[model samples]
Target: MINKNVFNKTKVSLIKINVAVVVSFFIIFSIFIYSYFKGLTYNSVDRNLNDELENITVQLTSSAIFSPIVLKDPSNMVYIYEGDRVKYYTRNGYFEDMLPKFRENKKNSFFTYTENGYTFRELSLEIGKYKIQIIRNIDAQINSFKQLIYVFVIGIIIAIIITYFIALYLTKKALIPIETAWNNQAKFVQDASHELRTPISIVSSKLESMLRSPNSTISDEVELIADAMKETRRIKKMINDLLCLTKEDSITTLNKEEVNIEQLINEISNDYLDIAEVQNKKFNINLNAENKIIITDKNKLRQLILIFIDNAFKYTNKNDIICINLTEEGRDIIISIEDSGIGIKDDEISNIFDRFFRSENVRSKDIDGSGIGLSIAKMLSTSLDIDISVKSKLNEFTKFNLIIHNK
Candidate 1:
């Protein structure tokens, strides 16, 4: 059984996980797109720089000069080369470093230089003694690439948020039918359970009277009928409990009125006191108040008490002691029933109230019960806004405490 608080938290956590996964996918896809575009832009810039430098170098070398000398246009990047000495130039002389490197060591026509996230590629050739080097402004190109990346990152984030909302919308649309199906299934089970209860009760009453008739003869057929009746009652009770398990708040036109708790407890205890004698057990009732009246439904509250008492007797061995105590606790009536029988085991305590959950120990003891007694009691107790708690130790004792609010 799951705790209500834990179940709620689990649901929220699952939703959070789903949202996180969707958001993460959105972010990742956006980043991939941004990187692809950034790379494409950088490649385009590099190609343009190379093409422009190659064109200017071809023109400058075509003209003959003395000593193979190179003239530096520390202005427009057009170089007139004469021989080996190379000088840098650009349209804006201050932007000379923007060009990529053209290295001399490889004799590979061009070489590259990198500084501050920028790559400078330079090429040089000689017509005379002066060797003019054409430098591409690599740093500025990279800086342009970086700016593009930043812009794309921002755009991607905005797009991802938008995508997240779309995903949420689609998921909600997909799950709407599931939620509706769950509601309908619950309603069907509740209606079916209610329909079964009346018929089962009628059959049980008829079986009872038939078994008690003076002319009735004990036979295998009669015993089989009794067994079948018991099974039918058991199934009916299970259905009732399953209906209760659903999340329907009974339209309880709860009529609240003043009632005497102490007198009610005393009366129930007295009614059951004679049963203990016939069954070879002990029943003790300790009432701490005279007229402990409060607002409640008399019939339902009485039914709840009877269920507990019935269970106490059903599972107990002969000669065991059962105690009922009624007391006032801070503006509330606390009714406790404690029984000394083969009490519930620690492992079985939580499931004891579950429908059709008969313990192995009880089964071994050969006790007869439909196993929905505590479930019905719990349902009624909850409807009446009463708190029910149980403390049971195997081979020691089992106790149920019912607290009713005075108001």
Candidate 2:
């Protein structure tokens, strides 16, 4: 049940994570592939140059200086020499222009040279009676390598587009729960506003009627005054519950102390004993742990306990037994409130702690509730880092369990 606003926010967040992971992986993979391919091409070029140089040296050795050797024919590029005398040249001025520059360097190696705006790879060699030089134009291979660069760049762009779509699909699939929570939150706001409007309208209408009938004395319209007062109290209670839910610093601003658990339980039970008696119900307390002490926010803990007890009292019928049990297990104090009251449905149990959610059974009974008690309790439990759980059987009984750790 994701609303449009929450869905959009969750979608954006998920898309960012997906895009980051995909882009990082693609970038690393692309770099590795590009480097591997470039290395392979360079090694191939080196091997070809070595083989070509070897072949040219063999041709020079076979053709002795005494023999009339014709170099620089249709395909062969060779320069012949004997000591300081030049026997043959590849072309008119091919050797004369660059041979002096090549002689200045001691290293006999393969290198690139530019002549008249043309690029060539040259390898100079010394034989028995001839110095043969082999030259090969590498402009086409260089162009191919440039083409490879363009292909790699285009491949990266295409990969990014594919990854973007994949990331978008994954993000949508992963954010279902966020969408659901947002939808639930939207419904909660609508429900709360509906609940608030009822009491507010009643209060407004009653006050308006009373003002119109100014001649009516206190005795004449006591019922109207009393009904208005009741609506006002309900509005006040609802406002207080909303405040408890909305207060961001409730847990931080709490007055914490070492509370005597047994004493606190006894005091709360005693205070409710008279109310239980007036309602013709039995209030029971079973203290399984003796002289228990816990460091907690006493007032917040008291409010939590009262909320459970009050909820039990509100749903329980006359002659029903409402029981409070306190126990210690390991390093944690467990407090449970059990009541023989109208229980919650299995399906409804999951949503009981959501804001402004009341079961249909309770609503059918026309019970007076703002439906904010359990939501406030849930918020308080999270703020205090406590665990709270509820177990109930429909039309049978309900129990709330609170686990308070020993700090």
Model 2 lDDT per residue over 159-262, tens place: 77887788788878777666676677778678878999998898888889889999999998888889889989998999888777767586457677899988
TM-score of 1: 0.49
Write the residue-wise lDDT of candidate 1 on 278-378 in tens digits.
99999888888544778888877887898888888876878998988988877877889999988898899888866556789987886766566676777
lDDT of each: 0.67, 0.78
- How does each model score on TM-score? 0.49, 0.70
For model 1 the local lDDT of residue 345 reads 83
Best by lDDT: 2
